[model samples]
Target chain A: MKDLTTENITENVHAINSQCQNPRTRYIFERLVSHLHDFARETRLSTDEWMTGLDFLTDVGTISTDLRREMILLSDTLGLSALVDSIDHPRTGKSTEGTVLGPFHTHDAKEVENGYAIHKDPDGTPLLVLCTVKDTEGNPLGGVQIDVWEGDSHGNYDVQYPERDGPDGRGILFSEQDGTFWFKAVKPVSYPIPMDGPVFNMLQMLGRHPNRPGHVHFLLRKDSFDPLITALYPRGDPYESSDPVFGVKESLIVDLSEVTDPEMAKKYDVKEGTSLLTYDFVLVSTRETLKLRKEKAEEAIKKMGRSMEDFQGLPILDVD
Target chain B: MKDLTTENITENVHAINSQCQNPRTRYIFERLVSHLHDFARETRLSTDEWMTGLDFLTDVGTISTDLRREMILLSDTLGLSALVDSIDHPRTGKSTEGTVLGPFHTHDAKEVENGYAIHKDPDGTPLLVLCTVKDTEGNPLGGVQIDVWEGDSHGNYDVQYPERDGPDGRGILFSEQDGTFWFKAVKPVSYPIPMDGPVFNMLQMLGRHPNRPGHVHFLLRKDSFDPLITALYPRGDPYESSDPVFGVKESLIVDLSEVTDPEMAKKYDVKEGTSLLTYDFVLVSTRETLKLRKEKAEEAIKKMGRSMEDFQGLPILDVD
Candidate 1:
């Protein structure tokens, strides 16, 4: 056996792991090992530094629970989540862009009706969220399910509070016959991510802030259309320029106008001068999304000098 | 702020972290983010795949304890530990090559004398460990401390058993006036790494076996001399060519000759036909090790287009 040196270690690792039964898995790990080895070599990473990194990772995992996923938080702050989302959900022509689902999302949110109040108690400025669901051809789509969630004025999600009896600042609602959806909820305020976790420590080490911009997360689904996981950042939030998670996209940033008209407040069942966030979401059909993604996957496979026949069993897109 | 995309996310992540006060940390993270993002792009990493990776990492951290470090196991299986050790401890002249310190080394080993029997119970083939400590110039160096440990015939260490126990198959000894040391210990048997952890699951996914070759760990230290942490693999072990941790080195592999002479067996206080393994360890002075490491560090910094002055605060080498 050839002695493992810095120069041969990378290839040796690859060769050892080259026998993975799944082509997709083997491909992913092959690239991962290559980049990981290159990173170590380029940095000439010291043993102490490596130990410190492992300690940080352990802390992150230790602090994680079913309610909070710190591993996802780590991926977010490192810009990895954003990059993956952008790659997997590349924008179709005029389609709404996708972003991270974030660690705060929960499947137990209450299903409410259009114009229903999602916030349990008034803890911040009253707001009206108005959205329209449309197709790539700008045609209205009814019966679309839109899940909305955000942190309260105190910058805490319902899950963050141990005494949370029910979901607050979050709810699931459907579009009306006109493809228009409106609801009453509190405006999302900029807040720091959980500071007790290792991700916060990493941000501190980087001399970066730990706050995500004020934004309302939305997960939209409809029959025959691609599901969109996204968030709408309020324009001009203090942390907008420096969202540590890098979840903000230019297209996802929308204006939060304060409507002083009493008539408008009465119509939306909110106090006068409440903030208003309105945007139209365009979603692509599953057929179009799958085609595009499959093409991209094939391109990637070709780039690696592999044949599509070898990876036919792998799911290129989760959508079907 | 520029919207993060696959093409620009790397630089944007770097820019967000550019304010790090420590130059060394900034440099390391700069390379890390660059490579991490490149890997994601190269793989076109999917969200599901990313989530799977995160889950694996969480499992690794969750299974770790003060007694067992799955993170180090993961690093070792990936050949990262071996690469770092090779880079950090390059051989100088005839000085013995260093390998991974491994996670098995403990600070609580009992100190004994030359020709002492370190094993608690006779459970395997009788063997005599004979070694001489010398300087790089080939001069004998007395009073050098050598810490030795290995698994028993059952392929398990003392720590692997939860039952109450003291140190077994491990001890600390010093070279005598003539720079020669000998000890009686059980022959090491090839063993798989802990197979109950996520690392083992990963190995299975990679279609790779987990066994490391039969080897005994040795850590040698003397005042003013650079410490050596390495292992001697018995020649002809079945797993030598494919050690999962990549810890084997050609120079560190040695033969185990059977000594059948009754007189020699009596001299070493072992049974007739005991196995004899002998070698000399050459150590470099701390001054020389530091000099070589600093030169390499400087060259690495220059390669990154950085100046050594910017990282003077960072400890380049653990050795003084």
Candidate 2:
């Protein structure tokens, strides 16, 4: 029968929620309630302000659809998506770093062979993408699966155009015996995140831009290896540094240099001066990934001033 | 061009948001981002977990409509609504404390004279409500407008029954010259919050019961007095202690006793065993409310390790 003041309501909430049967759910909710209460208290959040926030969240949810996920966009703009990705997929032993899987990705990208051009139209600038997959020891690994997708030169994904018939600027390819895969696609251009939603409204209110850096998304997987979800931001995109989603990383940014050699163009069957993006991905085995994650979990537990036992029932990326 | 590791992302987010022109928006966002990132890092929130939360929020929003406000229900269940109410309307002196003005309040309550019965049917136990309003010095506050509403004996508000026409169990009344008011209404019974939404689903997951204590809502207003939005829970309700919305306070709980006096029941136009609930409300002037809020803001800022300058542009309830 405890009365709830602003000071004691947090603990009251925790005590009430402690009846949850799942330990991980309880622990996550405990921290979440603590931070939520702390945020309200620290800001001395007004009733009006609280209502405003709730309304914004509701609007974000209402505006979301299959083609547009405003909730994920909200997370991205607030940096939670990036934080989760960073924490979940920490780089280990020269492995490729992962970034947020932005909502634009679709599961139905067209599959193509090596040296195939994914673009069906000539509206976008020609770009030659050359990628290689290797182990942490720099040994080429053949037959790895690569899923690549990017916005067109005009900064719109195929999904953004309801009139478009099929996927464009995206393809699935398997690494050749030399651990190399080449594909010709449009050069991605910096694009504003969807503007007709509460996320963009929030960004405008915060004096922040909604544009993400020009980038290509890559999803790589192989047997017994940790999958890589990453993006390569073109080096000179204006929004590179202040990517609204915070998905950019130093190692993931790549230079797009022009290849003016007519011999190279003839060999690739493309026009001269086509841009070339060359990058090699280093993959980490599942065992190494597990070790790194365990170490990270321990470090995080120590930093949180909590024993590992407090997180006992929580999953630690149990890929097995 | 800072790399957004889990460690540096919080500050990077703050830096990017610093371009906000409004100091208050900037400050609020700074704290929000800090806590959001902290929650993610401390919990090591996974991508799947993040997506689950977003989906839950989306469902909550989708379930809401004009008659139902699941967002406010979310705030209430999470204790944020109560927290904000306590912060906004702290009790000063002997003034009555405020609680959440829940989403069921409608503006179209029928105006009635004191002692008028708000119920259109005879379906519940009769109750006589006697109320008086006074200032801090105990001076009677005549001509005060009091808006009162409550759930029926079946534990459903008028709004919850779509087929029911107009407002019942609710009325607007003005105090007599002696600052006294009386009314005949159904004795409110404990009721579950709307159970068809994500909030209820969350409560179920958290092992919580969704019932609120039997209560009546009062909204008091006058020319210079701070408007009071509060509710009175009947004593001895089983759910009083753990109101799902955390709206119950010891001071707000009232004694409801059976009154068997035939003369009294006849006078109040009710049965012999009608319950009687008598409570007095103390109102704080708008000036006092502002002063109290300003002091609270200062205390909160100090506790937040921030100076008053950081909150300079924010409104402090300037009723004038």
Candidate 3:
């Protein structure tokens, strides 16, 4: 009887793992089975508790949609995202640190000219953002595409606003020939995650808070270089010490130092007296094939018995 | 930082277990964390893969309802239900052996008189069900409630029929003072699980079938005794070797010996020369609290931040 039970769990795990067709997926599924079985044995988990866990997971999927990536958010809030990111992008030297992309990034940002303001309802706190892209040796990488987005003072993204459109607080800009990029956007304010879902309820039940510090989203890419997807959090926000997603990285934390020099503001096309914040990004050369990543994703979907058409325009950030 | 990750997972596990409000729950949660962390470290699970698993679980919750019991079905199919039953019951010589309750048993089966046919459609071959409830020392338990349900010749339960109601294929009877119970229900046929949902898809992906052998559901209870929830399957069926739920136990298997005696058939209220199936159920007495086990369901819901109110009327099986 004991042998039978062991064989049963092993067989089920093998069956579930074999469903994956891709190497990465197969790797993951194989790991999941071993862990799941190990868990069963170690915990002597009851049928009722396992079923309850299954029920909980089911809710995670139901709450997810194009706009809400509950599953990804769950992963993020659980530190799985950071763990994966850390493994995939091992920090070697001066390469830009990779952080969570978060769930608010949209693909339809309007291309804005250098020094153009992306914020629609600027709250009169004039600010300028200047970024420079360079290689390990400090040589500027001109014409790099830099996508930028941030939350408003009220800690909500443009997409979260029902009446907004066309990237109200988002922009894409190209670096100048000297590898310098400048854009005008409001200073991002700290925000709390959507606390209405199961994630929120879990936090409440555990006596944890759900606040992420003030941060700006960026996805920078250039020819022959690794695509960098990350976020920059202000150095000094109370919640910075306890980001709900565990997204904060020492290298990515930038000081939004108050700049009062009028000449420095004028150089960035901001009003003479406006404040300014500056940060530089260093990128590494792309060594892996992007096509491989895309194929891995497609293979995962096929293994899941789904088609790309089923997920078209569905929000992918919730799983970020 | 590394220590922090370990601590976070540990604390989360504790939080989940604490929500269970039972020793069994706490035991299971602690075990689950050890296994989960081991799996994470062993496979270096990627963010995407972790998120996908979460997505699969979420779907399980969405598909579950008061009627379907997808989570219970999941547990049954995965063999966790049987493992749990074995642990809780432990085959004490004095108590009746327990099996999975399955998803079809409903509340308040129609009370049928002794020797009445429970099957409405008698087009199939007729079989008589004879059962006796005895204590370990062969003493009978009188006034015991014996609730029974079975599938039709087509291998479908009455509840599976949208137009049927009021226990079309279910019967409730009280044991005689001598601790003997007898009834007549249809000869059940083997059937497959519902071939939709993630569970079905998972089975198909794993190259496994969803067939379960013919069986009859029984819930026997008497005052001051451990209520027995079990199922009895015909001794011979091709799928008996691979019951999808692993619900078949050696003690629960009974032979349906062919009987051609007209006198015997007439005495049992069956048409002349009908077949007979004789089986007995032995129950042990205990005081284990058997209130419905909700498991870690609330933690799951809170973690996903989804409301359960939106999902009503969906069947959620409780396999004991």
Candidate 4:
């Protein structure tokens, strides 16, 4: 029998590499060729089946938008997002536990004081969240900046709302002299991923569900430490067993308990039955070179005319 | 030195396959694992760069729509479409040359008699096309059904028009007892693929053009012979050398000549300067099993709730 698979992949790799302008692109193309070839060899994949996969991908591209980040969803659903995240943020003894940043981090968030309210909607039950920044040694890290965002009670983020302005429910707050930060906002509710795009359609075709657990977003940064961008999910949401993007981590879960202290509530200007979530974030110092490298990578993408909006959305997974 | 690549792929494949229900699903997943692994090996690809590629794919999925087939375009641009077409239509000595069906073919066109007008829009110059169907032995194949569709001057198909019902500029015409079929329609002009989607964005990023040559679609069937689903391009088009979809075939090109005869114009009910395209289609009769197999494969997709409209607005390449 003829070994056509090797020939096909070699030719494909050559063609792709020839068309690429940069070393990175050439590297990616070459890998793509090898992998595609290996897939063909492993499955003895028929030509027609391969065509169908191509068709599926084309539909994926067509359904993508500024609000619906189907490509990111695809990666997340495929578990590639978590894999890449883990590999990029390899554990270095005491480094913070890394997680997927997700596709909803919109820039241009309002800069506010330490205890400002990020939510403008007055629908959900109020919650007070007190966060503190600390080094691995448990020393306070003052003057650190923390960016936060989360969905509303209905599980819809501010960006999902039409009338919202510039990163709804999103803000940048600096830690106070004691390295503590507090914010008043509504408790996030579990929401379904956007099911109107091809990702949803594909999930349905594959017999999967579209639900993600309740979670709050955070991006923390301080001098001499690696910036951490992650999400904290509710401790026991039903969907915690299967986050569509596989973003869940044991250490990232925060407990939200109801506090009935009238005096404490009055001091924080909250009602008696308000919910409170308290958690302290731990960071690890890293070489400035790594930070500079990340900044340069981001700068290159921006200079290439791509925006954060171009990369936001839910993952496509079998929600079974 | 740790070789995480093989171990990671094996673990993922094992997990995914354990969860898969069918052989086909398991096969596809296993292939995906191997391909991803091969890609990593070929380039020693970085996690961040891989994440960027994932981001690109996510955008592709987000932009897909019911009418615009971006995933199909991505496949075509990547040459996967051509590869699948080649494998599915492997030269079996007597089979019709198969090409990419593309993302623009509409389902269930109106059945019209020979010589009927298929074009609803009168903006472009009129063209009368004369076609004949014949067997490999040069004998006419009477009563053969020919389904036809073509893009307009702007490279937009009738299905792309919001106001159109069912398939526009798309219909089925049967050959008469003389094995001749004729249709009245405007001449298709080569146009650029939709630049609004990620496929176009990718092309721009890669410094590639998104042009395809003018072509007409057809799907011919007869009880005694093989059914043919294919497209024919104009003999000479500027972008024929770099057809975006790579669907063009030398034998499929037809000559569109200017006709000046008044009687000929009167017969076709067109003006003096109207162009006339004449082409004879020769089909080869293969084994009955092959024909049935192809039909069964096509039916499987149809059973999966796929319609021709699912493939609208796709780029059709010029055959050199």
Candidate 5:
């Protein structure tokens, strides 16, 4: 006798736990049902507004492609992406913080030596980035691979271009034994998200700006430290104060200092007028012994009845 | 300085109200962003779990076509469909209760006189349904149009069949001077929702049944009273106690009484083996004067910038 009452809706939908083998999956959906129903009731949402929401989600799917993921964009715009990231990689303050793995991350980007330029299209002013990778106690963590990507001066990712073949303004750089890595790229600029679709239409209708402030994406890895996915925003864009995606962290912001010295330019192998961005990544202690983490992740995977082979490359906490 | 922190995610996304031209839209989305983020944090949703959700929604879109609206089904499965309907059409206990206007409703149903049969391609026992339409005070509301539709004995709507055209097990009937009508249709059989897509996949994973108990869909209209959309569930079906969509209303459930008298069957033009389904629809008083409602709906539509012509047949709340 559930008569479509808001009071009973959440309870009824949450009763689907009769056979879910995965406790985690059931837990997630139970909360999802509760929260979604609560949101509708709290807002006293109208029929037309609910229809609009469905239509908006449909449009998000319609506009998604290999280059653009409207779902990620939607998650980012609404801060759900960042919120989930924060939950998984909680702020222990003992490690380099993690950020959202935006839809732009792809595999097999051209690996370059330290101090190489990733700005292939050359759409922005030249800049030299100098970064240091270290363990929690400030010891240099040498030979770690750092995969980096960012928007160009015009605030566009290489994949955003229709004619793109390989990654541009994106690279994988191996840090020196001294835990220092430097590279060349364009100055970051804030840009609007794709507004031609339904997500943006809703955003526009909501009186919200669709701009994401500029930043460089870094995916760092060593045998021990958990993969530290972080981003560095240029210190002072208007969007820095109000990033549409809530991506900016005060600790992650790096100031751009103008360096006119020719000697410094030669040492860094960059133009004399290049701006310098110096930041350091501090890795957290892998508290659980590497073997222990692997064993746990493997056991969890097996318990879920999924074969390891099918879950390859699925962030299994490598010990190598 | 929002570095994917859970604390600021809600605030950051809720800031999308700067440009929303529609006040109501902004209010709705602001609440949506808040609850979605809170849910992720409360559940500590894993990255893979979030990705699964995105994939699920994407599949929902991929499976949806002109005929199939998996999004609505997803909403229904989650109880969102029932929740929103209840919000819009609250139960005042004065009129016939409404239920989920399931995705099967269509236009251009064959119009028939009283006592006409709606079951065109019957696969089970035939039945005669006698229905009366009236106002809340029990006065006959004659000459109103009542569109009745239901799944056949197989629990399949005509729209679900690719080879079907027009409507079967569905018809539009006008109430006589006594506000009474009757139609012929097969007995409703409980059926599972389509399980070929991600929605049903998740349902199975959660160990939840996808069956919607047997019921008939009715949409009635008149010039004075507000249009009423309702559903009638057959009593004694196991799913009646646990409709997957939470659509069963106690006030809407009716039992089919056995008809044993031979003389009455012949007078009603029904066979001896036929069952009888008798129910009455009581319309609510159009509390607001007719002219006031029409003017308000029209004014609101115009203010929203949609032309009256484009929104014709869009529930103008006419009083004429």
Candidate 6:
């Protein structure tokens, strides 16, 4: 009789592997199975532990809704989102590094002009954000689109608040003809992720905190160049290097300086604030395709993290 | 600046690891993060591919309900359930092997005496199952409780059908003083698992069928002995070796011979049945503790896959 040893599990894995019609799917499933079996062995996981893990995942799923996605949050806290980001947006010296697309980026925010008030909440310190989108060689590229979002003064996203279906602390902005854009907003602050669910329970059980560093999430793109996803971390945040999601990168951290230029304050419409945020996005054509360079880019464009049916493509500029 | 390379992901992993309060939780999370990172690197997954994976998991969670758990089934079809089974229920030459506790066991099935009709559908051939529960030393332990369940002749469980709140092709039977029990039912047949959701779509995409070997699930227990969970597979089934869940074992397979004796048929109250299924369950106490396995056996007694407020323990025997 064939026994149920570790070796036989490998044999079964191979048996299932052979049945996969898609080669990439087969590769992924085999690796997943092997790692899972190894994890079980490494932990010598008992029945209760196994059940606990299953229950945890079930609870994560059960709480998922149109407004909240616990699964992605699970992935984030587990450091999976960071790993996938590293793989997809590899450290090529030229392009900006990409980070996770946290489950708060919505598509309802229309494209605002170069200078718009992104954080209109009256409680937090007003800060101005000025960014110049450019190619790697320092050539200014106008009409670049950047989807920006961050929590308000209370450290909760627009969606986190009830009766707030549209973006208040989020916006879509296009660079000017000179490839420079600016906006007014509250300086984003560090915040703990939702800690009321099983994911948080697991973190608490592990003695870990659920805090993410303060940052503004930006999805920047221009046609013919690859998209760059990065969170502009407030420089000197305590959790910058110790983010629970492992999303910190030294290059992505930017410190905002207090700008007192009277003329500049009037230009950006942040009359009430003393300081502003400034960061320029340097874009490049990594020429990297999606899904292991095998899948069509369009295939990925549609599946991106938004319920918005139409992704407004890059605006065509007179000068390429 | 440190780049977002595999090395940096490791750095991020370390950053998160430093905050873990519990050593065991840290170990598990670190290993999980490391393996997940490695998987991403080995696959060089793209953004779109990553999104697809996330969406697949989200869909799995979206469909989960009181009646179905697609996440556990996903684990089963991928052989994770089997690996966990083998880990938690290791290969001991003395006891029966354990398999999955499929999401169908209900506490509604009352404990019946010997020679009960589990399958009351009245459409299929009658099956008379006779079994004896014994310890490793061949000692007949009287008053063994065995919870049995199986799909009906249509290859569906009562729960899978509408409005069937309790078990029909299921029973909780008490053994006679000689440690034997008999039940009448339809000979269970091999059937495909529920395949109308994302789990089935994954199997289909992998070119794998959703068939499980035909078997009767049994959860047997006595007061002092360790519990035994197993499935008695009918011999000669087409999907025996290729069970999609990878749950087949030669020792668990048994063939029921045809018994034409009118006298024996009358004894079990099954008239003119051509086949008789007999399998003696050798349930040795491979003692195991729970997660908080330190709990007395009584704690586990009530929570064995039932939604009951109380677990009716083993029927008191005449002699302890």
| Every model's DockQ | 0.54, 0.63, 0.21, 0.20, 0.36, 0.29
TM-score of each: 0.91, 0.92, 0.76, 0.69, 0.83, 0.87
Every model's Cα RMSD, please? 4.0, 3.7, 9.4, 9.9, 8.4, 9.8
- Which candidate number would show the highest TM-score if scored against the true structure? 2
Q: Could you give the CAPRI-style class of model 2?
A: medium
Question: Can you give the lDDT of residue A292 in candidate 6?
Answer: 30
Residue by residue across B1-320, what tens digits does model 2's lDDT show? 44778898888888899898887777789889999988887777777788899999998888777667888889888888989898877777599999988878888887899999888757888888988999998999999999999888889888889796788889999999899989988888999999877888999999999999899999999999988989998889999788888898889888888768888777777777678998999999988877787777778777765566525424322112
Q: Cα miss at B249, model 1 (Å)? A: 1.8
- How would the docking of model 5 be graded? acceptable
Instruction: Show what share of the native A-B interface contacts model 6 retains.
Output: 0.51
Per-residue C-alpha lDDT of model 6 across residues B67-175, encoded as one tens digit per residue = 6777778877777777767665554566667777766666778888788888878776778888887776788878888999988988898878888766699899988
- i-RMS of candidate 6: 9.4
Docking class of 6: acceptable
Q: For candidate 3, lDDT tens digit of each residue in B144-211?
A: 88888888898888777778756777888898888777777778889988777788876675556788
Off by over 4 Å in 6: A1-3, A288-320, B1-4, B11-15, B18-23, B287-320
Native interface contact recovery, model 2 = 0.79
What is candidate 4's lDDT per residue for A29-77, written digit by digit as tens? 6446555544553343455567567656666666665655667777666
**Tens-digit per-residue lDDT, A105-175, candidate 1:** 98789889889887776667778898899999999999999999988888889999989887888889999
> Which scores greater on lDDT, model 1 or model 5?
1
Lowest lDDT sum, 10 consecutive residues, model 4 chain A, at A310-319
User: Whole-model lDDT, candidate 5?
Assistant: 0.74
Best-performing candidate as measured by DockQ? 2
Q: Kindly list the per-residue Cα lDDT of model 1 for residues B1-320, writing each as its tens digit.
A: 44776778888898988888876788778878888887776677777889999988888888877667788888888888988887666677599988876667677789998888877666788789888989988899999999999888889887788883678778999999788999987777899999888999999999999999988999999999988889999889999898888899899999988778898888878887788998999999988877777777667656656555424423222212
**Candidate 3, position B166, lDDT:** 62
Q: Give the winner by DockQ: 1 or 3.
A: 1
Ranking by TM-score: 2, 1, 6, 5, 3, 4
